[model samples]
Target chain A: MATINDVAKRANVGRGTVSRVINNEPFVSEETRKKVLKAIEELNYHPSSFARGLASQNSYTIGVIMDNTMDKVYANPFIYEVFRGVEKSVYEGGYNLLLLGKNTYQNGKLAVERVLQGKMVDGLILQEQIIDSEYFKNIEQYNIPIVSIGKLENRDDISWIDIDNHMAGYMAAEYLYSRGYKKIAFEGVELEKIFARERYEGYKEFIGSKGLSVMEANELLQNIEGVICLDNIYAYKILQRCKKINKKVPEEIGIITFDNYPLAEYLQPSVTNIEIDLFQLGLCAGSEMLNKLRNRNCEVNRIRIPVSVNIRETTR
Target chain B: MATINDVAKRANVGRGTVSRVINNEPFVSEETRKKVLKAIEELNYHPSSFARGLASQNSYTIGVIMDNTMDKVYANPFIYEVFRGVEKSVYEGGYNLLLLGKNTYQNGKLAVERVLQGKMVDGLILQEQIIDSEYFKNIEQYNIPIVSIGKLENRDDISWIDIDNHMAGYMAAEYLYSRGYKKIAFEGVELEKIFARERYEGYKEFIGSKGLSVMEANELLQNIEGVICLDNIYAYKILQRCKKINKKVPEEIGIITFDNYPLAEYLQPSVTNIEIDLFQLGLCAGSEMLNKLRNRNCEVNRIRIPVSVNIRETTR
Candidate 1:
């Protein structure tokens, strides 16, 4: 088989010049590059990736690490959209995506150990679901560039891109309140997740500002005239519960939720929802990670994706 | 800053001994292994993945190449479930997944070139949507083991795992036909896709066996009492169209579809669907690829995943 030496010998250039041409490194003269290319084409030489990696110290691959278990990631379509966005940017940036499942790590330390030991990826895009985890702290030792999908509390070392969860919640609540529904119920908040908690806080802040007390879901369903759900899936359940209780939607009770999933439009009373652009969020995260990978001093380290409310039949 | 030589010197062993210990290769004595481990820990030596990869000639990562575009993959929840299954098995097997999107390849040759030149992954799990593509033909040159998610026609070089689309379609037709529905309509058949075409053939074969004529979706909706949809998304569309035409589901018209997605039960008149175990399919593909990667001679090359029907409100 043909080797780099063979190509260099044929081109009458040094091995370094051949390596530069093969790696597409700048500074090589056009005359020398043309000779190297012709020699490479004639010799049918293909550079080994390991050799390339050893030369550049870059894998041209990004690791997408999800904190949530596989089941949880697949359960929510929002994650898929974000992944699609990340996939698009990664592909456009000339990098492959390495999906590291939750099981790949015991904790943050193990995850960092695996990445460092394997030199598996050039950079990482982490999906931080839990707020209090020590993942980011442990990852600091590696000095590898990382971009997170969700914000980390009390940590500025890593870059992140996230939807404005608080604003999403506030919009849902404010829309329902403006529809004259005094009693509103908030559902599906897992305080462990930073985003969910932020959304919940936004809802409470909106209700507090209006001088309207936030009611429990059960209480609101029986007495209140409206409910702001956490997401489209939650909205579907609320709609089902309303049917069981013989209450008419948008008449006796109005509804609004987050995530304008297809089900929101397909439901009997199509749900009014906060359209969080998960795809754009993924794209932002990918771009941030790419920037960090390409440039050590990336000026814009954090990004907040905006959300919009899509009014539907649930709000009448 | 610590290197393998430092660990080898500390352990009182040769560099090859330390290399074998780090690579986890067989033939190294347990006592020597323990000594090397202690030295490695004491020195805090981190092995360069490129150097390790060169020694072992394995990346410990598998590439998942999707034939269809990212949008199509994300549009259907089934793909996510399949990916979850693959992710689970891949994680358990101690390998990372590299997602290669459609845009990665300009053509079959370029796709093969990227995989070969980069040495990006040890093996590949290809999602083949079309049978007539030159992808498999070109991939034959690379001698790289591959496991396809769907079956391919006229090619036995690579292994594949797929649900029995013909059976799935037949079962749907049989169930709806038994319920006293004649002149049933089959929705969403793209002849280019093997599974879709298989399903269409199954439906046609069933209709032919019963000496009945298949009606168009428009005609069936106007006259027939039942319809067999292509999948859950198609079923949802059918339901929407029914509502638009003032036709009540199940009461005035019955429906059954493929892929019992989560929203199937949530629909007003819940859809009866063919429940395909996509996660299991993914697991099978992952396992098949792993076996091929680990063993040159695998017992089972072709696997057909089973599918069942879930009767719901749409059928009742």
Candidate 2:
């Protein structure tokens, strides 16, 4: 219920002084600033965000653009963890988060246009795996700072944070091969996805270097000793297929997957997985976006997050 | 890239007229509205959201207040599903979603005050199980409409949507009992939660009515034949405990749980569960909130979503 007038009266300053203090403008003296802050604390006066935004020409809010549909995003727990990470960083930076999705608007163009033209958010964090060059062209015209969560194609203008998927796959294959498994297979969906494809290529490279042929479905009869699953869902499907064929896990076959999902631990034979810190990925993207928004000369342009393998029951 | 001037020129109207049309202000004739609409569509001039918000006094944005910490919300798949439903409904209504959390701010009070006093969002959807009365009082003081996802303790002024936990529990108990399992146990977490307590109470009522004693942990030694888990996570834990004790699933024990999580189908014995339509629950809450925001005298105040039983391998 307290207003700017009350704060000004308590702090013994004009309304404009209080406004400047609230907006963090560098005109007020230290003593005056301290007095105004104390008065604000005492009055418990929360300024209207609209007024603050209009005065400062900044909303103190970050916009998160999710490229995936609601169903896909919700179904994959990875996205949730990433969002949580981004949210934590944004909150710590004293900024609000606005979720903008392509599926939320009539088309992807509209979604991008809304964010670019809104002039409501200070920065943007994009979580699109495959970036459209045309969309980036539109975003480039704006002065808004952006950070992508995954590697974007044909974009060197903005920063991005992602894990080394190829390294993850190479390590997964090497771990299985080191455990005395000769026949190894890679299971994945959406071969067109950059991450999935990179992982598969890495697995193939490791297998080829070891002078071992990649096991195909027909070769399952000849004993596929190890399977590198692209993700937890694929790992579960592989387990189901093994169960159907009466192939005992860990005893006759070993499995390693990406993204250590919660269900992985609860499965009968807990899955071994390459744990890419999804929350950390989100946090890094958010932090980078904040950095860019604060300092246009931010030096860090690209960041690669590391991945660790969680050795569980499935990998013996 | 299209400007308001272009739209006005194309529509043969003044810039102010174009602005009024975009803001949906009255006094613009029907024929003029059509011309402006056509012009806007052709030119693809997306107005600045800040300008639109200032002019219309509505942001067309909904704030989702979460009581849980970011980590907790991210870990729970049920929350994700509910969020998906809310997102779907909000998107269909052409509104953006802003996520605000207690942990995001210094405290719950600050979080509530920020959302209520910010004047940045049109309405709010609260997902907290236990809301503070003081916070609700503050929210009530504001003209902002609110919709709670769960049942609140004291206040009935705001609308809420939730599943019939009592009925869900009763049905679970009936199913286990009908399977000729005399020794039945109820497993739950967070007894403080209303839904959990209601479920436990329902299970107890059914057992007492049948003249059977509720089995305790010590009673498990005397052959507890069936276990009704409060949720999927507890169900996973129960299975782990059973495995540790060398009790084979289904043949020696049967289990049923709430929330048919994705892992439930992939679990070794494939958990039987009470399938609460979490998505539908979210959809109803979101739609109801939108209706209330548009119409002050919304007919529906409280909505109870239905639940069904998914008979899987564990309940045989």
Candidate 3:
């Protein structure tokens, strides 16, 4: 039941000073901030999300737009990890989270708009592909800040936190070639998303630079070989079909995929793929969004999430 | 782009009737409901979460209390699936989501207070264990509606949607016994949560009912044999320690865990376990919570999430 006035009085500071410290405003001196924090701790003061949202208009709440309807894949795990990282930082910074939508539904934009126009959240973290030009066009009308998880090819206007997918692709191809596997094939979404194109570019560049001919057939398109994709069940189909192709994995042809999913290892041949640092990506995105909310920085933002290749039994 | 009035006029219903239908009021007749639905479909009208929350003082947003800090485990693909299910219904219901915190951080009443007092979310879907008594006691003060993924023991007053852990445990034990395994053990939390107790009870009942004398040493503490779990991590530590302890899994003793984690398969002799219908659980929870919210039903509550045993290479 202890109020802010009680903490302010006990901390020997004005209510405004206490509010400044609580808001994490930089104006309060370090000594005052410490005293205020100590007093808050002593009082066990829990700030309400609405009150915070009202006072600062910085709900610290980020609108995460995920295509939840997509099949649970390695890419999803990566995204989830990134979400964790972002959640960690957002919580530490004292922010609430607003999960927008699972990309399959068109309602995600409505969720975002609610937060934007209704003043529910401060900023948004969009992990979904901006395929709906109309959605984006409507979104562009509002000045609500957005930090897309992955970079978009044509939409350079939006801010995004992404991994160096191009470099990851190059590394995978180079690593496969170095391991004495020449006929390396890449698999995953062939969408215009930056990760896909960047990965393809990296894979092709690495192979071409080595004077190795990258076969056209090796480039698997959005359609996987015999994989049955039933609304986000891509991983199983890709693995099952790969088994039927009479292709000896790693021995005859090495395969690399973008986004490391959980079932990756459980697969028959076990997939060796690049793992994007989704946690760090989320953390960076959350932090950047927080920073933007604190200061209306409208400049174009692009954050690169780190990637690590999991050398598994699949690659031999 | 179409307004609610436009839809109402097209459907030949009052604007209030359209609103009631959109809000999912049960009083609307099926004929009128279909008309409103057709109008909505034809118009492609989207309801914002804020408008819905403000109009009814119900955000249609649920606070998902999950142990996100824990390592992503393979054994519990249900978590992801449940999340997907929750996403499906909640999104379709035009509700947003907010992941509250991991078990420890949101440990006691703080989590409940945040959700209840803050009024950020209309209802809570506790995805984690409800172990802390003080937390529950504090939560009772707010009078906010709650829908738990796990059971709240000894408190029949609250609403929750959970898996039949006892049945799941009974099934697992019976499966092991039927497979001709004489000695078997269950691994889970040593908390006040209903799941841990139910699973343990089931394990004991099945074994004792069979006239088999179960040894106490066979039961692993909160820490499973060979796993050094401090904060839901060190999952591989258990398998590594098993290697050190010379307790060959599925050979000398059989193991069954409650929640399936990710790295369960990577270990030699992948774990045999039951999978909670997390998606169904989530969907049901959302559906039930929304129903309760609308009807304010007090007497009829409590939903048991169905579970299935996933027999992998682990069980002998």
Q: What lDDT does each candidate get?
A: 0.76, 0.77, 0.62
Per-prediction DockQ, in order? 0.35, 0.36, 0.17
Q: How well is candidate 2 docked (DockQ)?
A: 0.36
Model number with the top lDDT = 2
Q: Name the weakest run of 10 consecutive residues (lDDT summed) in model 2 chain B.
A: B66-75
DockQ-better candidate, 1 vs 3 = 1
Q: After superposition, how far is residue A95 of candidate 1 from its true place, in Å?
A: 3.5
Q: lDDT winner between 1 and 2, please give it.
A: 2
Winner by TM-score between candidate 3 and candidate 1: 1
Please, what is the TM-score per model?
A: 0.79, 0.81, 0.65
Best by DockQ: 2
Q: Please, what are the lDDT tens digits per residue for candidate 1 over residues B147-170?
A: 888897767777899998998888
